[model samples]
Target chain A: MQPESLEAPTNRPIYSPVIVNNKSAHHLFICEGYPSREFQIFYSSVDDSKKTLLLVSESDSTIDHDSILVTHSELTAKLTQLLGEMPLSTTIYVLGSEAFIWDVHSVATQAGMVAEQIKMFAPVSGQRRLFCTHCYHITEDVTHSPAVCSGCQRNLLVRDHFSRLHAAYVGVQIDAEDPDDLPLPQELI
Target chain B: MSTDQIKVRVAAVAQVAPMIREFTLTAVTGSLYPFSPGSHVVVEMPGEQKIYRNAYSLLSDSHDASAYRIAVRLQDNSRGGSVFMHQQVKEGDELLISPPANLFIPQWNAQKHILLAAGVGITPFMSYLPEMQRRQADFELHYLFRSKQTGAYQLELAEQLGQRFFSYDSDQAQRCNISELLADRPLGTHIYICGPEGLIKDVQSVAEQLGWPDSVIHFEEFAAPKPGKPFTVELKSTGKTVQVGESESLLEALEEAEVAVPNLCRGGVCGQCATPVAEGEIEHRDNYLSVDEKARQDCVMPCVSRAHSDRLVLDI
Candidate 1:
């Protein structure tokens, strides 16, 4: 099933809410899922605030400030429609790494919008997300060396994310610090 | 006397070809139990100095189990099992034997039986031939070999089955047009095929186009290809996930992940490795499952199957 339309499971894969970083909010890219981030922090690095929304593209070079948008396949249209009428100050970024996304990006670009704003955030090490079987939301920060998911309490080892897409979604975010520190569960957040 | 008293003695050994070897075993218990055609026996061979159990198809006619015939083809890349069976085994040696077990057999009353064999895949069919002749069953045999020279028992099989036998020698680049040949046959005939990955795939795709269902197709594989890449695998029950490299089969990957998947022949022939595929796509490279099973994407052989999706998800 596409990431969209996925409902919160009555029986969650995880029970304990462990430490999570701000970047975990991008799981929102999957849509209909809860966005979990501590607090939206102001810029300390990269683009400084000029009241500008950074339009991250799969390719930074291809990003034309005045051009149409381009991005990954399925999410492009919904994203384009959502952002197409927004002011030019809102910069969009597209994730690149393959053809399917490339086509989506190209189509978005031709639609008379900024194509270069799509950010390409590849999953980084130590910054990982875990699907909570109990909660059915992609969660983060299990404990132990090969950590057991705080959600389901099952041992979470590397490569386990690919078996079933159900709770296997994980992507690394740019700024993740003290991932071990437990935070309030999303139910409370 | 008892099952424990039965013993098999190797009467002769021959390295018929680089990859193929024949073992002639005679039951030393004075008498042997009857084994049906297409039956196989598990033989214990000396491993280093110890014994290891290996299953081999009985090539000798099933009418007499007192004497057994088995053929083993050494995998090009040695895993020590086949290579050792060919290297150390000698004439006049005794090996433990199991009663014949078969996953392939002829339906005695079935009107038509179509047999398709590729190289060493012909071993099981070799046993079926005598039964077909005895019962005067309407059977047709098609043997496919890389070359005429590679065809085993070419003359003998043809002599026994007469005009019903067809040969495809890849060496001479001669192969019968199976699709065209089968087009005229009646609908009730069962089609059995066994061979290499490429050939099996070809036959399956063609059969699908021809609208053949699962009941019509049966097959076995002598070898299986390892998957292409190492990727991530997730276990649902425990919510545990593991990395499976391209070098390892899904079964091996699961084993490493500490997930037990029931399996017998890791070569993708036996259906023991069959498990439910709850999610994700797979690159099927097995001979066991029917086309319908493959289409449903519900079951797969972990021993030799690979994932088509970046990450594969399975129920088991």
Candidate 2:
């Protein structure tokens, strides 16, 4: 079934889909995982009135297709053209390891986005799965479990292990009455 | 040119303190890269990292260029750079750094050499101690640290130079008196000092009273006074003008003016702040530039250095 608002899958096999909510003002948010090599393209009406935010793995393939670099130039250009048809403020966040995010900012700057406008972030631990082959789901709790896979588990060495925390939340809106004032989860271990 | 420049990959990283960490970077490009006693490097890391440009003094020995070392102390109350460096950077990570550059080096020929340091200001002095020791140069090192634990590079230094190194804990004991320390130092000695603003000022004045010429005294300052109010800056070449808000710096002002001025050490330590002066006077605030350089009216450090006059025009 098509998700009503947006698809936000957690710690499961089905990779986080390209979530979009156009009910209010045609806002779109894209989230991708590794090994999926996913390609998402959105077509909006000429009169749509909403902002969009794109969040992708820093290790994901670029939209340019010609260059193997992880830059979002092609994605950004496409979104820029799409935004021309709508009235909204769009933001793209390149997610990955700490170094990857830093590189994303550098590349994004070279691509000409105002340094202040670009939002770069990495996922907190447990909230996101760290897979070895981009296809396998290797939980951080595997040491306690007794299952093995033939996938790229050997290559599953952690990247940005220390930099990408499990409990930290990104793009979360905190309210005065909200119980979880802390963005990070209580028990990261 | 010296064949002593190389890019060293990180072999390991050790977190010595909550705010400080040491990196052991092994030279990958070449076998050996020679550096002077007191010098620093420009390090580059991967990604859209915010700590894109930073200068760290080389704490490693100048004799061994096979591997390079640096200690970074994280400043949480920072403008995003140092915090990122502390939290994000790790071991096994590859980084690019320039060959060592130094503003404080011991005069090996001097009959006596005096070294003074405060806090992490002990970095350049750390390298100098060994260099002077190797030369068998007569010198005394006065290490003024807030706390023994907070004093960076203490363990290694104390282990190496047992007697010549003097440790002063300001938190427990009274502040170190320059007059008292200098009065004992034999004449014909050259002094090299690096530390906070207050200590640098007091020592400079005391050294002057001791009849030490400016030529015999060398020091490095890492900070400057906070900008007070907004001021106007005019660019002579581009004919552009901008108001430097209190929240912003003169470098930010020139950047806003769309003027290109080469700069590093945005903090004003690295003479990278040197900017050409055209028609107006500037309030010199940096310690890197000499009096003659300031009098030439050719360049100014826009980062910490500011204009004393109401409206100043820059050559660039």
Mark the regions of model 1 whose C-alpha exceeds 4 Å error after superposition: A1-189, B1-7, B17-19, B28-33, B42-55, B94-98, B224-262, B273-302, B305-316
Clashes of 2: 15
Compute fnat per model. 0.00, 0.00
Superposed by TM-score, candidate 2 places the C-alpha of residue B59 at a distance from the truth, in angstroms, of 0.5
RMSD of 1: 21.5
Over the stretch B24-85, how does candidate 2's per-residue lDDT look in tens digits? 88867656457898877756543352224456778877877767777776653444445656
Candidate 2 runs further than 4 Å off: A1-189, B1-8, B44-52, B223-234, B240-249, B252-273, B279-281, B288-299, B307-312
Model 2 DockQ class: incorrect
TM-scores for every predicted model: 0.49, 0.53
Task: Please give the TM-score of chain B in predicted model 1.
Answer: 0.73
Error of 2 at B164 (Å): 0.7
